[model samples]
Target chain A: MFVTPGYAQETAPAEGELQTEIVHEEGHGEAGFPPFDTSTYPSQLLWLAITFGLFYLFLQKVVLPRIGNILEVRRDRIAHDLDQAARNKEEADAAVAAYEQELADARAKAHGIAQTAQDAAKADAEAERKSVEADLERKLVEAERRIATVREAAMKDVGTIAEETAGAIVEALIDRKPDDAAVAAAVGQVR
Target chain B: MAEDPIHQFQISRLIPIEIGGLDFSFTNSSLFMVATVVTAGAFLYLTTSSRGLVPSRTQSVSEMSYEFVANMLRDATGPQGMRFFPLVFSLFMFILVANMFGMVPYFFTVTSHLIVTFALAMIVMLTLVGYGLKTHGARFFKLFVPHGVPGVLVPLVASIEVISFLSRPISLSVRLFANMLAGHITLKVFAGFVTTLSGLGAFGVIGAVLPLLLTIAITGLEFLVSFLQAYVFAVLTCMYLNDAVHPEH
Candidate 1:
């Protein structure tokens, strides 16, 4: 059946042609489904081969590679960007750690300076207080020594005055002048 | 308004190109096949021309189809199966586009024929066998001998598996062809009912409404079938090749 019945294609003719079509089908002739027609197989296969082969070639060579490339580029870009982000974050973290360390060191340094200044001031005050105390003690000792010397001088005068007064009283009470040697001897015996 | 639903499938010669006395004339079927390729190719090529890092809507469709087929193959046969991506992608696109083209009014379904679908199925089976054998050598036969059959039933099971293995191409071809052929024919017949019913006077036109609605509904269902059949074909191809990739332990 290289050929289908002529009336089977694109046209439903009058009753006579329809009757002929039915008769051909009754004979199990070429009046059947169009795809089942073996006559068209080679042509269909040929064109199919041509078109499909061309299509396959086009895709394999051009389209698929382009798509794969685009996708790969995007994937690589994303991975690279992510890596950059991670590196930046690490650097930031290190910077923060360094800053905090510097801060801690400066704080300790300030504390040490304050402690040294305080100690220096306390030492200076202690030295000045010690010098003032020594001066006051020296002045007090001088004043005590002067007062002892004055008291000694006054005591000596008092003793001599007492002796003279006693001699005069003796002279006034006696009518005659007394002998110097005997008066002196009596005073010495009483002393 | 011809009652012959078979008229849509007629392959009229558009450009009769006979070669060396064999009737290799370019027909309407060939024209539509070209259309399918151009449509699929143009849509993909133009949409991805910019190769946008961030895809536009149409570009997303292209990428989605790529990932869709890629994921299907990858999932079925792992990364090793990516080698067959070009073939699988082409087959998926061709069948998908052909089926969709058939859905348009009066467009010839290139894949509606047994020879066409059978040829496609043979492409897959041939690849499965050729690559499977070329890579695995004699070990490729291990696909016929599954694991864990008892010693007594190993012979029986191996023969059964061999027959099943052989039937893969036939089944694959027939599934797509029959679905496309039968669905189109059924749609034609139902749509013909509207024509036949409306030809009668007033009341017949009114009765035509039911078949018209049915025809619309079936058309929607056929569109789903078009996409699904393509997916199923690709999935089965991947699975069949998986046998080649990692045979029974």
Candidate 2:
């Protein structure tokens, strides 16, 4: 499989006869491709210079500039994208920070208002409790004073009744002028 | 036309002497090779020397070549492969200069010969294998056995992969050598036709005109082929180099 039929046949013709001669004689020589001739050094060098110079000029003048322009455009595009991305990222971060700050500020303001309201409620409650307690104490003192006055008035009436009974008993005893036993019984009954 | 094709391979000597074993015979082929190196060197040096923000014409060319290979390597092997830029760039320039130099009237296309291209291919293959081994150590041998294969088929798959891997140099060298050789040979054949027919006089002259036109067309095509072959060579080198750098693929 490694042996290529075409090349193998071409290499050694039957019985050592040159196969290349037949092919060469078949009008292919005039239109034949000659191998590279290395005989002339100076001419070859001169031509090499000419070719190299031509290509160098082409690259230096035409192709390179076009490619360079493309590269520059690409570089500029990449840089622009990076810059835009950075700007966007910064804007996003700023927005987030601003939101956080606003949230914190709002929280602090709400806390202040709530604290003030709570303090006011506490003070009002304390004042209401003190006034109610003071009113209860005053009512209790006034009731105690009325009870003392009523007790004194009842005591005076009782004392007057006792004196009238004693006077009646004495008149009965003097008018009768009775015996000692009778007087003693009358006095006892009156007492 | 000498019957032996080897005679054509000679380049004229600017300085001639037969020293002992040194045999530093500078021929036309050597001269062109030297000139190509110098020109390539100068071209790169001049273009890349300044490296300004706004590049000069030469600088622009140099930068473009650099970026072209850079982009290609990056695309093929990812950004990690960027470090191999120098090797890929050098290979591209050398093959390109060698190819374009061959397009001249009487210069040797070094790439047309198997030895030159084979050497390049060997280098690429060796680099690939060496890097793979270095990166993965003993496990580099695992590259021959792809993933997800059944245990039973492991041996067959490994053998096939190994065979194909071994054939890398052959394919790489042959691709370049064959293209350059065929294109040059075709050009020569057409030129021969124009010369031989032109000798046939008036009516033959009209017949010869067709070949001349064909030759002109072929010459233009040859120029295109020269560039294409160079591009193919460079691209393939990049691909192989990609495997070297990132052998998992």
Candidate 3:
């Protein structure tokens, strides 16, 4: 909606006079409006240019750089965290591998020590049994030799007793010493 | 008709004041600009104060404002345009506030004035040119001289491109100023009609009622227009910025 044209300015007046009147009237046209002067254009333009320059400087120098720094920091932090996690994982894996190897080696050593001890015990048992058998065989041979000796001695004693008895019998008939004839006669009597 | 609109313009004396070599008065326009600034500050402050996750009324409005500009930038340029979100957002908010402030009973629409819009447009143009020059240096001159053109056609194309580039400020400034000025003037005319009609009898009262309803509808539409115009201004700025950032496209 527009304001009505003020009484539709008198258009029938002389052209040159009307123009002058219109110019005069225009000076009071919009009382409430700000004055429009081309003189201020240059100054206004200067201010606008200055404002824009300041804004650009602030953006390029301060604001944008700060934002860029933040992004860069975020990127580096992520990369650092990832790298540290990888390194820690590698260290953990190496430690686990070493522990497993040590565990296997310890078990093998324990098994070897047990086997050596069992071999030593078995060898000692074999040597003790052989010594016991040898002692028994020596005692058996000594006992046989002693028995033979005793038997020989007993036979001799019997022989001696027989001789004495025969001699005594001869003496009872006629006192005689143990000579060849007496011996033969005693032998016949005994027979 | 005055040959210069400046001749038509006069600074009325409301409260006489002096500042340096200038006559500084608390005139209607000055009062309105102050009101615009205050309203803008308060509105933005209140809307953003309670920044809620689920959006308590205020936060929703704030988020919507952000999203609106974000979407516009993306649409005008590309997804990469999100980088200019804050710049575009601020631009939209400033313009929207300025336009809406003028809608109040007695306030000046700074954007309707040519000098203000021209200054804003000049900044965009300067940024575009400066950024292109900084980024591409000597090769940026190639923008005016397209590739694959015969030597004979180069001059014609170069001239055309130069003319087009030179017109950027004019087109940008005119678009915003014209829209605001025209809309306000139209609204004033319709309101004048309603007031005039209301003075008559019953039939005149009925006529006044119709115009009044139309005014109400148009006012709501104007509010939407204000937001849209701000969006348009910001999107264009972002597009220009993008061109400067990557000029080949």
Candidate 4:
């Protein structure tokens, strides 16, 4: 049957060749169609088998392995990078936490130091006030004592002068001094 | 003389050689097939040669293609389907390159031929059968007998299942071949219209504009189809392999 088809195709196309050329019509009835022609089947099949087999081998051995390796390596590298990034992020977070803790501690210590200085200044002010008040009180008392001594001295002098003036007056008027007791009695009476 | 669109697909013997009554002549199809292999190989090799952790643009493309097929296999057949990565990946890359290469001005599309695509489909089918038998032994037959079928209707269901199973290779191969052939043919026909219409004067030139735009649009779409068809082929291969891995369903 295959042989018959091949022979028939060859003869039929030969007969129709003249008319087909005249019309410039291609594949109108020549062997029906080239793809359907059985004459070329064996050769085409043979070559396809041979070429496909070799191509398959090339792919399996050389191309696929190389591609697989590259892809695998790339995957592994990406995973490794992601893991490293995660670790670095954790380290950065820890550092930030430590820095914040130190900042808080320093602030607390500074606050404590400020509180101590303020208390010291307040105590010093209180001690200075008390000392100043005591000094003022001592000075006031000494001035009062001095005034009393001066008053006593002035009273004694005034008494002596009064006695002398009275005696002078009596001598001028009567040419004689009176007795102390009499004079004292008379002055007392006049008073 | 108008260039023939179908002439792009013709297979002429570049170096005719016969051995033991077999035609082993190296044709344009063979040339492009080798070119596909080399192009795919060089692309993969050069892109991944650096193996940078941070990939270049080409490396990213290479890696994306790898992961795309890898994910497809894993999703369809689970982790156990990874063993067929080489087969599925090679088939995907080969078909993808061949389809895209055909979009160039004068490149031959190897996947457009039934024999080539059928051979690839047969390989996938045979692999499924071989692996299923090897792994599951006699229990692999359970695939044809699906779960939750009525006992009375078991024979009918099983026969349908068997026929569908047998048709997998045909369907898979035909899907790729037909899509490529139809798309290439459509593109060629539109392009021919552009050339033929433009040759006839002012009115014909204006008429050619629509076909020219269509050709451009189709070329862009064909690029998408080129990639998508390869993806479909690989995914189907993975699904078929799932049966080998888990033969119960």
Candidate 5:
């Protein structure tokens, strides 16, 4: 049965060959499909082995490693750059914070100086006012003492003049001059 | 003539070289395989030659591709899985470049072949097995045995697990192969319809417009599929490798 089937299959391709010849002169003639042809298997396998083997070697030795390295290097470089950028940003943030702090400190120092200058000016004005008031008070006291002395002198002079006038009137009216000691005593008693 | 869509996938021997009775002929598939490597290598070298701290557009794309695979491995297998980054990354770039190149007109799609994809899948499987054995010693068999299994079902479950583990490479390789093959075949059939119909008559030409439009649309979808298939392949490989690394459950 197997022999009969094999013979029938061979005849089928033979028939196909005769028909194929009628259509095209250069027909491959009963070769059927190259893939089905077991005759060429060894050569095909050999070449596949050779080519694929070399291709494998080429990839392992040259291609994959180079590409792998490129990818790895790019990845590392990117990560490094990102890290550096983050560090720089942090530094910038710190610098800004320091600058703001210094700015606040400088403003406070300026305010303190301003307050101290204002206090010193006020103290100086207060001292000047006190000295001027003291000088004026001393001058007023001296003027009062001098005015009292002058008034007392004028009153004494007036008393002496009055006694002299009274003596002259009495001499003219009675033609007799009172005794000088009595006149002096009378003036003193009247005063 | 109904052109065979399968004809697009024929491998023609370009330079027949034999050494020690071995048929090591460089064929169209080999040419495109070399082209895929060269293009991928040039793309990486040119874009990364600058190694700019700030990458250019092309450089960014290159870097994104690297990180894309790296992240997938790390997520699936953790940091320890990074030891297999070169292998996983190589598989991803190779498949991705090969698939994208296949979308170009007249370019051979190497990954469409089962042999090529199976070989890649085998490498993933081998790596898994080798590493699992090396790291975990005989205890790696614990991967096939679940932690919480009833005594009656242990044999059944363990057998199923072993089968599933063994099937990884087949499924992984077939997924890529079938997707590429089916997509390319569909695209070719639709494209063929456009040509065949247009050649018939004016009425046929009018009918051809639909297929033409479909072909264009499918081409766009194919590009997306190409990238997705590559991503799936790489992601599945990572998961498999993860099982190898941590095989407890």
Candidate 6:
């Protein structure tokens, strides 16, 4: 594909101007190094533009988006999973804390119950001991009063019995009723 | 039968189409360009068509390529350069596949041509210059004027910087073109030696083994060169595009 007859002549191997001009160029001597061959440039440029354009369009429209989406989705999934795990750990910690608090509350309630029972038992035992002591003291006082009354009664009877015994002795010995006033005076003097 | 090491670089017209005054012929170069696109496109399309969340072996290749270029661009130019990913990716795949195609016997290597690589390089430069001027305007000139230089040497430094900036396309294009051209030529020469030696009888065949081994080793090296050149091109493109966005420090 020749751009111009002159341009084509440059690469056609020492023909036309090149044949007439100074023994032709060194690299351009024989078949001409093809890369330097200017005639083929137009086609190469055109096809490169076309193919490269198509390739750029295809990649921009299709492949990149797909691959980018996959990576993005995976990153998002991983982040979400990590967040979920953190939340789960926090919730588990909260549950453990709640369980510990309930156990502490139960322990405190049991201690209070035991303290109230011990206080109540101590009060009951104190009341029972006081009542029993009061009952014993009352019985001892009543017994002491009964004994005093009996002793007084016995002392009062002793004068009468002494008078009676003296009269009986006088009556039995002298066959007569001796004077009660005399016996009483004599017992009083002896007491 | 063809023994000329340089002969492999010849261009032949396939479907010669002359429209108006221009020759728009489909050629061996063009055929391989189309082949490069088709091969790359079909591979990506077919592999990713499944859209598996967990990729298979083939699917991983498609993803790896996409990520490789994507990361390379992002790293060079930050997120601002992401917009040019399509252009960079296309260039990479096209060059890489074209180079590989050259390795297949009888297939033309498109990247070996100066015009092809120069045109691609020109595209990158044009985009860089165009975007830089449009976005940064006169401030884009800051790219040539590095900071911390003594005021007296500013002009000298800037001239050097300007010359370097202007030569970016030349260096970039020539790098790919030369590597492909030289590697193919060297491989051809070694292969030619193998054939020429084998024709000299039993002792010749024995001697041919060394060259034949050299050809195989060169072929392996050529494959590495192919991939490396493509990668280098893409990386340089990113750095240039980065210049467009950021302009200077």
TM-score of chain A of each: 0.60, 0.51, 0.51, 0.47, 0.58, 0.63
Give stretches of model 5 more than 4 Å off: A1-31, A133-191, B19-22, B150-152
lDDT, candidate 4, A23-128, per-residue tens: 2234345444567655556667777877878888999999999999999999999999999999999999999999999999999999999999999999999989
lDDT tens digits by residue: candidate 3, A7-73: 1332222234434322223433232233253423343344334443444444345433443344456
By DockQ, the best candidate is 6
Model 6, docking class:
acceptable
Judge candidate 3 at residue A70 and give its lDDT.
43
Model 4, span B122-223: residue lDDT tens: 999999999999989999999999999999999999999999999999999999998898788788778878998999999999999999999999999999
lDDT of 4 at A29: 54
Candidate 4 chain B minimal-lDDT segment of 10 residues: B1-10
Summarize candidate 3's per-residue lDDT along B121-231 as a digit string, tens digits: 876788678868987897777778877889999899999988988887888888888888767666655666687788787789888987788778878888888877887
Query: Using TM-score as the measure, which candidate wins?
Result: 1
Return the lDDT, model 6, position A174.
96
Would you list the rank order by TM-score, best first?
Answer: 1, 6, 5, 4, 2, 3
Residue lDDT tens for model 6, A84-105: 9999999999999999999999
Clashing pairs in 1: none
* Residue B91, model 4, lDDT: 93
Tell me the interface RMSD of model 5, in angstroms.
5.6
What TM-score do all the candidates reach, one by one?
Answer: 0.84, 0.57, 0.55, 0.76, 0.81, 0.84
Assess each prediction's global lDDT (C-alpha) against the native: 0.84, 0.65, 0.63, 0.84, 0.86, 0.86
Give the better candidate number (2 or 3) by TM-score. Answer: 2
**Tens digits of per-residue lDDT for model 5 on A1-191?**
32234334444665565343222233453344457666677778888888888888888899989999989999999999999999999999999999999999999999999999999999999999999999998999989988888988987887677667777877888878877777777888988
lDDT of 1 at A178: 64
Cα displacement (angstroms), candidate 5, residue A72, comes to 1.9
Interface RMSD of the candidates, in order = 5.2, 10.0, 8.5, 6.3, 5.6, 7.0
